[model samples]
Target: MPKIARINGPRAAFLRRFLPLLLDFDKGDKPTGQVTNEKRKEFYDCTTRALVLCFGYENTLGNDSPGDLWDTTYDEIPAANKMPKLPEPESIERDTVIKALTPVVHTWYKNRRTEANSPAGRAVLTQRQVERTVQAFAPLAPPPKALDVYQREFKQDYIDAFAALWAKKLEAAGTDEDALKVLKRQKGGKERAFAAMRWDQESDLKKKEVVQRCKDVYADVVKRHKSLWGSPHDALPNSRMWSAISFHRRSA
Candidate 1:
């Protein structure tokens, strides 16, 4: 708060210039200026993701929960009686997956937190022979609304097959044998997300180190083996050393 109060502070001018606009933009009769509503929304999504990653990327890399930090920070705000009160956002927890087998690898930490903290409320049902009286969300249209809440029913045997399938994936986890070649293909697209920036830098450095190591090893072997086999014009390449070179290149 003192830092914010300081007139010469780095962000003081920024806050002063933008704070009123930020507070007022959520009000009625808003002017979006040259930007269209769709463009504003598109930029909002990208900006929100970028800012969130900036705020939480290091904590995420260190295996901490950003959501917990958000809650803790919110609780520490000083209260003023005349301050505008912002109502909490409306949220309705939907039902969890049924008898389907859940993959631990694919499960997101956020969804796990939601599942643990928020229970699905009882859905209002029909009194008679279930003519679908209870559509949980009143604002939602009837059927064909692209149900993200639930999956289409699958046979028990088909769901059971995923166990064996993922078990094969577990066996192939670190090997070059990616099931869909996705891991290998995505390597061409260098990591662009801010969330993985540190990891991406480390990975790139490791690749350069590996390439340098390979070059050094190649040079050392050529110099030493040249002493044994004489000039390349006088002698053919050694079969065993060439085989080893091939093996090392594939491993790299």
Candidate 2:
């Protein structure tokens, strides 16, 4: 008699327990070639549960709680003695899973259109339920919009440029009394304090000079930091700059 190889390991042990449950699609007696609404719901529910299990297993090996598995990719399971090789769970990218499952979903929809065109076929999934299904398996949110990305980069660049200019102006003047007074009144919000500096000045000429100097510094900083704000042509609008300055003044 030939001896059979025995599968042994934590992974094998886990699969032995859950794999059958994961594949257990049949609940009871069902009609042949007919995909009912109940069946569709059950299928998605089962898939979601199976994903949770896989996520749990990955989390357990990494000494992390299963609850902490949302939006995170699982690490590759190493091949152990007598265990089968497992692919990294992270291999399932958004496009990859959608590509693989979309065909099946389309086939089901086509079948519904041709064969099961009754009320059962017309049953639509709720938005909440669809959201839940997506949240269960999706590794990350959709990428940010182009405008949002540009705005974020611009905001950071503006902060760095403003900081450098403020430092330089302080060094050149040897005293930042007016700026410091505005800062104290504005409770140390740099943007607000800087804006307040113009209003706090008693002389109209001095105020005009302060505002012009601020505009000049901003223009120079933008020029110096052009690379950080995406393209060289991506300039901050004068209206937005003045509005930002006035907003701080009003807040102060």
Candidate 3:
């Protein structure tokens, strides 16, 4: 059976919002990214780790509990058996919450682009930074613009979307029924449990993992930017700054 990879909660939340935006390249092990290959791996690993941690896996069990996942330090190097998986929302209702927040993800990336290219020494945000910002919007009341629906309504709608999409993907992939059983897990309480588990888990260990993930992702971000825009300009302004200005100018 094909196993789902695991990730930390914040990264999982970010994926719930922006996964639809990623083009299904159907090529490499990792999703395609504008960043460097190493950065892409960092993105994939960090996001998967976030999902796994958030989804209440035994590996991430709370410190107070006998499971005590905190005892095991977070390591970027995967053990032969360790696989980072995102705990997918199981039902239409839960999936709705995931889908409803998609816009927040888009807005985050757009905002990051603006910041990275800012004329001044604005914060050169990395993908990790952007994911953190988007994750902050979870449980937020549905904004009154394009997504002008009640929170309940949005969650339901998101669930429906996720169900439909999962069915299609599973069918296309020719996956086994048992392999997809994980998708059937009840979502509402499970999602909350996953979050609480992280809270009860050791704070120090969690902090260390988060920082390491961020650093790895940051290195990738730098590689990606350099690859895309060529080396930063020798003079005061960098290529990213110039690119940002041009992007805004074109949009304006």
Q: Per-prediction count of colliding residue pairs?
A: 0, 0, 21
Per-residue lDDT for 229 in model 3? Answer: 42
Best candidate, TM-score-wise? 3
Runs of candidate 3 with Cα error greater than 4 angstroms are 1-80, 85-189, 231-252
- Give candidate 3's TM-score: 0.23
User: By TM-score, how accurate is candidate 1?
Assistant: 0.16
Give TM per candidate: 0.16, 0.17, 0.23
Q: After superposition, how far is residue 129 of candidate 1 from its true place, in Å?
A: 55
RMSD of each: 30.6, 25.6, 17.6
Q: lDDT of all the models against the reference?
A: 0.28, 0.36, 0.38
Q: Which ranges in model 2 have alpha carbons more than 4 Å from their true place? A: 1-27, 31-33, 36-92, 95-252
**Candidate that scores best on lDDT:** 3
lDDT (10s digit) by residue, model 1, range 1-252:
011111222222211222222323334365455444444343333322222222232222222223211211122222222111111220010001110101211132223223433443112111111211121112332222111111111112122343344445546665656543664344213221221333244455644554555455445545443444344345323323343454588999
Q: Write the per-residue lDDT of candidate 3 for residues 43-83, one digit (tens) a residue.
A: 34443443333333332212112211211223332331343
125 Cα displacement, candidate 1 (Å): 41
As for TM-score, the candidate ahead, 1 or 3, is: 3
lDDT of 3: 0.38
